[model samples]
Target: MFNRTENLSLYIKKYPVISVLIGMNLIVYLLGLIPGIGNNLYALGIAYNYSISQGEYWRLITAMFLHGGFLHLLFNMFGLYVFGPELEQLAGKLRFFSIYFISGLLANVATYVVEPLNYASLGASGAIFGIFGAYLALVYHTRKILPQLKQLIIPLVAISVIMTFVQSNINITAHLVGLAVGFILGMFQFTPKRIRRFREK
Candidate 1:
């Protein structure tokens, strides 16, 4: 279910939301490759606590689409590319969008609340981690039939959390908060009654 065998056109047609997200991140990253404008845009794009305090609250949302480097964009987009569609299919587009963006915003907000005002972070890792958290919720929800999911998802989540600490410049708070919020929302969004109803259907 996580595999993608579709061509570009078919993929976009099948997963319009994920495609747009990946495209937006790609566009932002490409624009940030520019010489002078790059630095300026990045300064504005990051989720800076000072900026948020100064009433530039949009950074929480905008930073979800920004990246520090090519690999940063690539990894985040790849996570979206692989995991997003299944959740979109299961949760529907609106719910999927809510889970992703809300988790990201909450993550950034958590950062704003805890970190120094000078703190700034840019990347979709928070949102991607939300997707991971949602997957965990799903596995727990459907463990009877989809027990196999734990093997893939648990290890992936574990490795990600581990990497968060092992890697430098990683926003540990955002990632953890996003994951927690995503799991909560996932549980709220995909209730037991709903899951049972879905299986019945």
Candidate 2:
């Protein structure tokens, strides 16, 4: 079901939220390339715990779009490009955007609460993990229909978590919280039976 067969225009038409987000990330990254301007945006956008506590709450959202470098942006956007469309199709655009955006925001919030005051970070990894978590929830319930996804997602999550620790300079707090939040949200968003349970209340 996850395939990259569509051209750029068609892909965006099919998954506009994903397109806009990826575009936003690219635009922000490009802005960060401007000599004087880039540094300013970086300072303002990076998720520094001290700044966040001091009331720069916008960083939580901005940090999700900001990247330390091209490779960071490339890897994240690529991940989104690869995995985002199916969820968008499954959850519909608005809910899909909610899962992605909320995951990233809370991930930054968790980092602020849990990390050292001096801690600073930038990237879309948390949001990406959120997508994974939500997809995981869906794949799990529908596993009887699509058995391969369980096999795929479990190993993927484990490996991602493992690398989160083994790799230096990674924000473990954001990743874990994002995953947890996504899974919880997914429980509501992806499951028709669960959604009906809530609506009946």
Candidate 3:
């Protein structure tokens, strides 16, 4: 089953933009290892209490690239590495990029609005979830042609949603909100007309 999916390096070759994004995220992670500089870099994430409300709205976007710790960064980056390339290939570079940034921003916004008094939240999970959502949209949109993908996409989404609920300190709200927003955006990207045109072409 897994062998049916394309290799990551091949996918990146086909979609260079996603490669650059992955590189950028990795670069940011590396920067976060520079001793005091790393600490300062992390401090830039959207802190609901002290930082975000202080007009650091850019953190909504920036925080997507910042991570709390090694494991935190690893998981988010791994998710992006696995899913983002496929999404970019299916949606086209521009549309895929749009979904990632917008969904991530919405995730951060949801976090800020819902937990205005909470401490800082960071990582690319929102954006990664956006890619997952885009994958769902693409698979659903192309269901007639690629009916088999439903088995993969649907189960993955279900598992992710379940994990969101079961995990402690997992920022359930951000995950839910991000997923919701991503699904909405994915729907638009995979509108019937667009899908038909894409398939026809």
Whose lDDT is greatest here? 1
- TM of each candidate vs. truth: 0.93, 0.93, 0.87
In angstroms, what RMSD does candidate 2 have relative to the true structure? 3.8
lDDT score at residue 182, model 3, on the 0-100 scale: 80
Screening candidate 2 with a backbone cut-off below 3 angstroms (N, C-alpha, C), the clashing residue pairs are: none
Q: After TM-score superposition, what is the CA distance of residue 196 in candidate 1 from its true location, in Å? A: 5.4
lDDT of 1 by residue, 3-23 (tens): 788899988987888898898
Ranking by TM-score: 1, 2, 3
1 versus 2: better TM-score goes to: 1
Residue by residue across 69-133, what tens digits does model 3's lDDT show? 77887787667766666566557878888888888888888888887565668777887788777
1 or 3, which is superior by lDDT?
Answer: 1
Model 3 misplaced regions, further than 4 Å: 1-11, 196-201
Q: Which candidate would rank higher by TM-score, 2 or 3?
A: 2
Q: What would the per-residue lDDT of candidate 2 be over residues 58-135, giving only the tens digit for each residue?
A: 998889999878988998899899988878877888899999989999999889888899999999999999988997
Per-residue lDDT for 64 in model 2? 94
Task: Give each model's clash number.
Answer: 0, 0, 0
- lDDT for model 1 comes to 0.88
- Candidate 2 CA-lDDT value: 0.87
lDDT of all predictions: 0.88, 0.87, 0.76
